[model samples]
Target: MSFPAFDAHHPPDKDLIDDCVHCGFCLPTCPTYVLFGEEMDSPRGRIYLMNKGLTEEPMNDQTVRHYDLCLGCMACVTACPSGVQYDKLIEATRGQVERRYERAPEDKAFREMIFQLFPYKKRLRLAAGPLRLYQRFGIGDKLRKSGVMSRIPARMRAMEALMPELQKEQKVPELTEPVGERRRRVGVLTGCVQQVFFSQVNSATVRVLAAEGCEVVAPKDQGCCGALSTHAGREEESLNFARKTIDTFEGLNLDNVVVNAAGCGSTMKEYGHLLRDDPEYAARAKAFSEKVRDVSEFIQEIGAVAERSPFAVTAAYHDACHLAHAQGIRKQPRQTLKQIPGMSVKEIREAEICCGSAGIYNMVEPEPAAELGERKANNILKTGAEMIVTSNPGCMLQIQASLKKMGHDGLPMAHPMEVLDASIRGESVETLLRR
Candidate 1:
């Protein structure tokens, strides 16, 4: 196939792109390629454009457009047999786009708004009240139905649709007293989105940690993990946010910095790498990163995790890509669940695949995201699990929405901690929600 001239605006590293062997392994698994039959949208083609863009050639609008459409989902990295390191490639490319590409002001504004509010927990919590008013008056519905978003660019349209639903005002309590024999002391990350939206999940995580014999310290000074900002290539903003988070948690002499949200966990665990340039914080960041753990990893490691799961329930488990593939944490969550005495954790087909919820992708790219979610929902349907367990709040919302659309009722999605809490208490799992 003939290639177009590359644009200088979105430069990828040449060495990384050269590593691609033109293997088709990444094609079948790409949600976009899997849904749409365009080779230009496939991993192989994206790499080709990246190679040209790296060499100072002017990349054509078509080439740049294709790259702009990428969701940066990292599936290509998982699928690439050649180890092309698409993570860095895509991240750098996005940075170049932000610096050199002339995106519409409206588009830039929308993208910046998320970074402005989402990484600041207090700001996000304060805005939730007004957002509820928008939802209550059906303003969002009217705007969406009016097709007003079409007047803007595709990227902006994607951003608008991803607007989060009305959220609750939930902030972490400074300290949660220990419940059982307190064997360990640890800190739990209060994520910006999870704090305001999935307040119950974070609360359940605190309860579970306490029941498992750990003093759960929810430091109000703790800042957002800045995963969303970093993923979007807002380097300066993300670095500041990361530094603040490190500063907040480092003061606590804790065994582990436990995070319930898989996305935040993945980012917090990489603090060492993020702050490597800092002479003072480098060692401290490494030490802190070492302490960082997903709630499942912490539970499995501590061995204080309970096993007397007296409730009988059928549930399907959805693995978060950030937890499983990004952090190499595949077993602990399932193991934690299987330990529950009476519950059966049914295996979901294609468990390794993402359920169309790579951080903010579902809200941003609703069409393709919904398509993949429906496919995942069908797979879950065969398992016939009454409830679904996923570690990340984003996946829970995306899957739950798909389940609702498919007319599955009362199968509210929950975190692994909720079940872990029940198992340790020797109470029915249903009590956590009902009570």
Candidate 2:
């Protein structure tokens, strides 16, 4: 258990850590704390450990483990009445961990693999080929039935199981002209994983925006927005990605940058905070951050002008943690869903709790992620909704895998944008599914 010397540059803010009154308001909302019933795992407890690590205590395995267990859902931030900035505290702490801690060799390799593969669009595309072939040839099923999957690493097995049914990737053009009078001109973010895996969600988002009389500008070469890197504490890498993303869209002179994925949107909207230290990009990043908007948020602001038809199905809307907690967007997504006639948005218990898809969390920490996923799945199933609707691709995959694991694979799952696109086009559910 070798530990690198603590780096002072990214130490947790003592002022923020001191803000926690330890009121226990966050205990019930923290998924790890609730699951483990360990004081060291709770928000207040982590803040205490952060104080120790920052002041005099040496960084050790126990300290690192507590932080590793956190999902970074920001539910505790939402739950705290004392205005403790747990999000910033956790992020800064993780940055220190990345810079000043030497993880076990295998853990380091796994993280490096994830960072290298996930943040690069082309790498993920090329990597998906073998996975798609495996799924296409029914080898995945054969391996599972033969129990060979059990011999593989837990993280690898989890990733294999959560592999989405591959679809022909849809490419968004440089510019999509609005149908009627263009009320707003917006740039759309085609996320890295979302573009490769759930490309239809981005396509649907563009279609819906165009249908609502918004000109869509989706740059073909724009790269990942650095949500995964930032969430995982690769601060320097995240800043590089943020600078590139700002450079990609800043020249378009668009009214807004629409993001359908919750995590990307949340991080994009914080570009100012991420780059505030950069002398050259500070102002530009602030301006760029201001223009970023979630699709649901943008639609609500502009009002849904497209006449929607009915899709009479009971669906539960799962709040992607970033959307609901980080971005404080709760009503807009539900409001967007309600526009379709006969669409009943049933409320699931613990809607604010994460589905254990905090970026690549389920892949990195399978045990706790699976527990939270199953907890989320059971609550959603109890709602008796025929489908699960969410805005984030990660959450959709997370919930879908959980449901399948629970033997409730019959439930359909989709992004809200997808459903809205279907209604706006008057397409049947069968047609939507086929796509």
Candidate 3:
């Protein structure tokens, strides 16, 4: 448990590193550690490097390499008994890297594009619609088979494999009324990728929120949560988006800012710090952050489900790393899944392990991401489940694409909110059932 003794070039907050007791309990859960079997890939070891970095210790190539390889999955944060706040450590280190280091031209361009486009909803929608053509035309299949992918740079190929086919999008209407009396008024975030990729998840989110006697606002003004940007250390752009978000929902008489996408929710919850430097929007940003809630947790808090009926479908609930670890929400989504009639929630092994879709990590680091996704898919398959339920759009794509590649693609992938809505509305989710 003895950590490396040295000062980083720029030390992080003393309180953060001091929380790590250097417990190696998180070693097995880390994707990089599991893959490379290197001490530096382990949580304790990373903390050591982070500590060293923050303490002003000199960085070697090895230190940078391991940090670069990190998915920032936060599985270690969940596994640590001492409650080491690895999420902050990793993010702080990443921000420092972005400020101080230089990446290759392609890496810089792609990462910049992700940060720029992802936080702006119009840009995302406009971009996604055309990309949909490439996906549906099976360009991915062509690339995989043509050896053209081999000729390209590894990182670019990695990006291509991460995208899944987008069916027609179904953006929610601006306002939706619940079936019964309104008990709460909330704003639902129509996330960037969720809108273009898993639009149905947003639909179900509105349906469930409505079914619970709440009025839902799918505000056209609420853009992305700046998640992909923030996670990649594009701090200024993320902060700008955060300001717009504050202005987006400023007037809503909201009980909460309900977020169905876990990664977005996690990012939103951290808006306090994301905009800390904004003189005009700092207070508003923090206020907006406090109002943010994961849809499942909001549902749980409002007693959205009165009872759980026994359903017979064997369903596996895949926990998105951001939801379970970064945001510290591990139970409500499961409860919602269990509420469906004739459904059985089955637990998968290594459920907390990253499916390798952290922000754009899958696209940027495709091989490892794919390996993790396939590993996750295999474990999910062993559950004998008829369907897999998850919260994040990225996780949905990663798992669904992996399952499809493995020929188990026929099995369904959906958000838990969808399941809850289907049960209450007695609506059959056939599209959800379809791969």
Candidate number of the best TM-score: 2
Candidate 2, 105: how far from true, in Å?
Answer: 0.6
Off by over 4 Å in 2: 1-5, 433-435
Task: Kindly provide the TM-score of model 2 when superposed on the true structure, using C-alpha atoms.
Answer: 0.97
Clashing pairs in 1: 6-58, 6-59, 7-58, 7-59, 162-363
- What is candidate 2's lDDT per residue for 131-232, written digit by digit as tens? 888888999789889999889999998888788989889998889999999999999999999999999898899999999999999998899999999999
In candidate 1, which residue ranges exceed 4 Å CA deviation? 1-13, 131-171, 177-181, 305-307, 432-435
* True-vs-predicted CA distance for residue 270, candidate 3, Å: 1.4
Candidate 1: tens digits of C-alpha lDDT, residues 1-435: 122342343346677788989978888767677778788788788887777765545555577677765666666777777888777777766666665567667766766776677677678778777778876898756875798746766655554444455545555677886776778899999888788878877887888888778888888767788787766666667778888888898778888899999888887787787677789788988888888999999889988644465768878988887888668788899988888877789889877667887766675567788888889888988998878888987787777777766887456577888777776667665675453
Q: What is the lDDT of residue 21 in candidate 2?
A: 93
Which candidate would rank higher by TM-score, 1 or 3?
A: 3
| Cα-based lDDT for every prediction | 0.75, 0.90, 0.79
Q: After superposition, how far is residue 165 of candidate 1 from its true place, in Å?
A: 7.7
Q: Root-mean-square deviation of each candidate, in angstroms?
A: 4.2, 2.1, 3.4
- Residue 35 in model 3: lDDT: 85
- Models sorted by TM-score, best on top: 2, 3, 1
